[model samples]
Target: MGSSLFSIGLTGLNAAQAGLVTTSHNISNAGTAGYSRQSTVQSTNPGLFTGAGFFGEGTKVDTIKRAYNGFLTNQVLSAETKLNEYDTYSTEISQIDNMLADPAVGLTPAVASFFEGVQEVAANPSSVPARQSMISTAQSLVARFQNLSQRLNDVRAGVESQIKDTVTSIGTYAKEIAELNHKIAVAQQAGSAQPANDLLDTRDQLIKELNQLTRVSTTTATDGSMSVFIGTGQPLVVGTNATTLAAQSSRSDPSRNDVNIITQSGAAITIPENLLGGGKLGGLLAMRSSSLDTAQNQLGLIAVGMSTTFNAQHLLGQDLNGNPGTNFFTPPTVGVQRFSDASTASPQVDFADVSKLSGDDYKLTFTNTTGGYSLTRISDGASVTAANIGLSITPAATSTVGDSFMILPTRNAAANIGVSISDTRMVAAAAPIASAATSGNLGTASISAPVVSSTTDLASFGTAAAPLKLTYSSGNISGFPATLPVTYTPLSGSPITLAAPVASVPYSSGMSIAVGGVSFTLSGAMQDQDSFTLGPNAGGVSDSRNAVQLGNLQTTKTLLSANGSPSATFQSVYSQTVSAVGNKAREVKVNRDAQESLVNQATQAQQSVAGVNLDEEAANLIRYQQAYQAAGKVMNIASKLFDQVLALGQ
Candidate 1:
């Protein structure tokens, strides 16, 4: 009976000693990250039974268990991922917002100054200094556009670099996690009664760190190995194997960097950028695809609209040298990128109508050999035929079905915009034709300013078929020539002679006449022998009509949407772009803050469940020490009984 008591007491002592060691370990590692509080489980040993009654045995230590909640850990990881996503997005987009809103460094001041210079030129026509100032302002405006484009390109480059770094880091984490998974599976499968708590903690810590770089979903197997997936179930790690990620150029747009996973067989699988949600990498991809791309395209739209409209109107007037106006600003060209696998020839793309441009990219997919192609606007996913948007696609005879092309109307416009006319004297500011009454006119007949109503009129203005003369006789004009036939039609009556020269034609007040593609209106009573001259303006140094028209383009509704419903002026579009970026930045910042709070709450909850408490560990230490001393007292009592029995035998 004493020996059995001694054995039971030894069991109690061992159990108490184990409890003390576990409590000490928990107290020591309380501050360690990812460490879960561990405790030794105890169970009653098998009882010793006798005829009278069953005897109680000491307690036995079972296995140590870690205090971990999978659900809470997952919640914390999810919140952290979302917070990181918005944080990165906010940081990147704020750069663009600041650049666009800057007073001195922004495009607003440059646009205002350029138009102000145009106004000065209009006020002082033929002033060399004023024209030079206009040219200088135009050059400055062009430089501003180029600088902004370069900055945006730099941002793109930086995003690409970040993506590469992120991919490398993801690969590193995947490799490490895979290795840890193998180690854990081996340790867990060793059939040991002890749980590998430290290994599990280290693995969880790595997964949490990986989640911040990019969103990842983890699944644990029965063997204690975990698999990590990203971007809608694309495996990053499985068991002891990890798939590598590479930052490569996009298949459609070489300028863009995209993420792809390299398979074991060396096949690359592209992950759609939008599928990657929540993390720094996802945020960067979103900024590049949506925010930055839209801003740059809108800026390019403004540049194209201003340059094209201004140049078109400028060409309608004559310059200081009595020559027709040339282009005032350089026109931007359309961008076309053909797929590498496409067999069709690249189509010719141009801004057929500046007022119809939508500042969006289009995908042209040829469906059949019948010269049929479907056009899809990338921004809105609206579908139309190529001819619907004024795009002329000339497919090759060898073109096959499924051939694709990407057309960018305004993506590169701002960067490539330039000043076409360097010489200020070439700035057209005068009407092509001048209208006046002859010096010998005997009536109150007068002519308004001559307007070259068509390109045909402007082309024939100074040619041999021009300089038309008209003579009035008995309320009739008879000086019309055969080469330049005149169409005389009354304001409220039918035309008299629209063919060759007429011997006699009835003339009335407010009569309209068109000759050689030029139209003019004459008013008031005309006497016999009254005459008028319609010729090109020889010296139009004071003409500011075209300059005024050029300035008017600043407020003209020249930009149109793909469907031609929404339209805006140059300044209006720019203002909208600025407002959009600012609003997006504010929204992302708010979301980031909210998500950060959620992460903190989740983390606290997780810590509360699994965190070590020093006070509790200290109490456990005292309890286990008392238990060990009591078990020792029982053994001492047994020893005293044995000594008394032996002394009695002596």
Candidate 2:
């Protein structure tokens, strides 16, 4: 009986010791990375002989197993991937916005300066210094355009480089995943309780990283190996082999390189999974074409419009020494057509000087909805019609070679007709040449002398009939009727004589005219409409003249109409640019919010199944302790029984 009692007590002591050891093991690995707490499952051993009725042997440990949920672990990895991708894309777009919107460091100031110079020249038409200043400002504008374009190109290059790095990282992670798959499969086959759990953790981590680079989905095979595929169901990994990713320039444009992932055996695969909901690389690609390229092209288009329009006008008008044709701005090439280039050329058309030639000498050619124009010039009481501008290149004997001339093309509101007149020079009357008319001239010449009579001549220098009548059909001058003639005229209004000669100089370079019943201001301020408008009494008038005058050369906003109403040509481009910017910003905000919500849901799901629980571990510890105690009780009972038998023998 003492032996039996001692055996029972020893069983308790052994059981207590085993239970303590199990608890310690669990505690030790609690802080270990990727270590799942282990549990000892106990079961009773079978009885040796049970023919009649026999009690079972003490409990034994069935297996030490890890507690894990595959679905929960996968959910965590997937969430992490999406979070990284969204975060990456958001950061890239913010950078793009910063680059574009930067004020002092960007193109805005340069554009402003160019227009300001134009305004200054317009306000001071006769100032040579002002004209020169305008030219310098124009050059600066072109330089800024080139600089901005280069910076954008650099951003594109950086994105390509980043894509290459990302692809390399994807390949590295892919290889690691393949290796871990092999390890896990091997562990399963070997019947190990761990089942390469740590390897699996590492694989999960790698896959999360891969997802951030691009979108991916996975399938578990029967053998426990994983098949990874990106968007469009292209396999990235199958069994032990991993597909590699590469970068190559686009087929049509070698300057742009795109990422491609394929199998080790060279099967093409659809990569750039992140592009659909891509990360940083994807964001850049999206913006590269949409915002960056489009904006640059739009800016170029603006420059093209300005240069082409100005050059067309410059080509038609005679330069200050009456040179028939000199290009105002050099014909533009594919891209470089800045207005500043037009402002700084030699013998440049002075936007400020409206006094150089006859009052009616200025001719503006307008290609309206109608095809042809018959225009008139109002200068020195002399009127030249569409039929008179093509007179002989040289003036008659009564006319000097260096006489100033005027060609006026007016669009009459009442007549609904266009008339252009070119007439030879007469000395300015009392008022300024721009506002002077027939009453201002002191000469004997009259308006009808050049166009109606062939015998009239400028007897003295200021004589009115000495000037020739030039006429143009449409915008083109067809002929000049040389009815009046005069030798060189002087300050005394005396014609050149064999005894007393006179000095004559070429006509001034700049002139202005009133079209459509309103005078269009040509001040430097007229170049840019950033802070100006042509509304009724706002800047000038409610007519089409003010609209065209206030029209922005740099911006695509139709300030005026060709037929004198509101213009639609310029407003369209402006509206389109504004819409594009707003849309991109909205898209970024929406995607960012959606991604955050998805991450939250995924995180909660992962936590529900995979998260650690201290209370559950405690419960498991107690259960394992009781089983160990039962096992020890049987062993102790056997030992005491043997001891008692030996005592009996003694």
Candidate 3:
């Protein structure tokens, strides 16, 4: 009986102490991250064995368990990760939207202003001031284009930098996780449950962060280690070791803006992980590649289109003050020659100095019955044959500047025979001056600025404003001496001729001017064959006068304009930007609201399951106290029994 009573007292004492410790532990870790309250589970000790069977004696601690649900924890983690990604994406989109849509610096207003300037020039074509305004406006417009392009480029560059940073971060996380795997595995092997719970918490936190940088998948090994992998089973971590990730420049051109990820083993991994819907890096990359690049390319295309098309029109039209010259605009070309003569074993055409010439300036003329020739320019380094030109030419020993090759009437006139300047950077050949300059040549000129409010001027210039006039010189030049090298100097308004054996020569309009075997017709007045138009085509690199091509802006796309201007070619780009912003804004608002509701619900559920009840704790304290007192009484009774036995033995 004494033994039974003593065991019961010991059991009670142990139970009370365990309960108190559990309560204290819970209270101590109440604010700890990811900590769950622990409960002391009590169970009756194995019953004392009697003659036939065992009977329950007293209570003892069964197990201490944390109050937590894995499913709920996982739900919270997943939702939080998605919420973080969306928040980052929305924020970045908003910044980009502000950049594109800010009215003070937007492309639309600049485009509108440019077209308006063009209209102003058209209203008063002869006005010097109007023309100057057109030039100024064009300069401003090009400046804006450059500015927009540079800004987009900056954004792209920033994204590239961020990608590098993310790669480094990914590497760091991978290494840390692998190290933790080593530690955890070592602890597990030591025959203890091992403080693995803390390790798991840390690993989970790292995994969440990793998911934000890129897509990742994880697998558990039998040895309590984790293996993390990326796209296509590219292992990031295996057991205690991790592979490193690096950013490398593009293979095709290192200088260009591109990057790729290489594994520790030097294998390039195709990681569009940056495009996955997980992290800030992915969103930033998408923003740069999908939208920013497209916008820039669109702008470049616009510039190219304008340069090519406008030059074509300007080439065909005769400029005022009629100067016989090559077309003002020259587009880029592959320097290749077309052999017009099919029958002739050898036919030669030469333009050693094609610096001042363009393919558009060339015109074919047939003089002999043996005509049928093709002209083709080589592309890249490809050879061109007479067949390629789609026309054949008869034998001729030598081709001169004036000689021409006739196109077969049956052949398609459009087939490659006349490819308009596909590239805007082509250089053209320069022609010789016509009227020689000598002493006593008449050439004084003055240009008047357009009057702003003269009815007569307005009527003349098509603008409700005063008209302006630019003067030119036209007269006989025979009185002056000739055959001497004469330098031509351009005056403020026009070029003055000096030395001249004034050759009075009148030919039908549209007579082709052949320079270095390339021919173009002159539709305006000229002092013999020497007059040339001041065109958009600038001199080539070798020539000092190669100003036009070098001075103009080079672009590949158009910009959207405000006010619905016809010249606004990139309206779609702006429209898409606006749409993206609106969509992101809507999505953010909706998601944020939804998240708030989810948080509230989660909080309520957690409170129900894990919230501490002070009253319950107080009741537990009283119950433990009573149990302790009862155990004390049992001890006291045992002591009394022991004392009585001792007295009897004595």
By lDDT, the best candidate is: 1
Model 3 ranges with Cα > 4 A deviation: 1-4, 40-44, 57-64, 191-195, 215-217, 229-234, 252-264, 301-573, 580-648
Return the clash pairs for model 1, or none: none
Q: lDDT per residue, candidate 2, 1-650, as tens digits?
A: 44544444454544455555655665766565455544445555564465676544434455555556777666655565555555665555555455545676455676678667656544553455654665676666666656655665676677677767877777787888888888888887787543555566567657766777766788877667788876456667888888887776643234556667665588544444334445444555566555555555444443443444444333332222322223334343321111211221111122121111111233212222222222334223334433243211211223222223222211111111111111111100001101111233332221110110111221221222232222212222111212322232333344332222212121111211121121221111111111111111111111122112212344543322234432433224434444565567667667778877887887667644544456765776686577557656665777777788889988
Query: Which stretches of model 2 miss by more than 4 angstroms?
Result: 1-54, 57-74, 192-194, 262-281, 287-291, 299-590, 614-634, 645-650
Error of 2 at 28 (Å): 6.1
- Model 1 CA lDDT for position 508: 84
Please report how far candidate 2 places residue 115 from its true position, in Å.
1.9
What lDDT does candidate 1 reach at residue 23?
A: 88
- Expressed as tens digits, the lDDT of each residue in 174-286 for candidate 3 is 99999999988987678455345546656866876786676566788888898987544567889998887776664322322333456557777445443344455555555
Tell me how far the alpha carbon of residue 426 in candidate 3 is from the true structure, in angstroms, after superposition.
18
TM-scores, in order shown? 0.89, 0.58, 0.57
TM-score of 1: 0.89
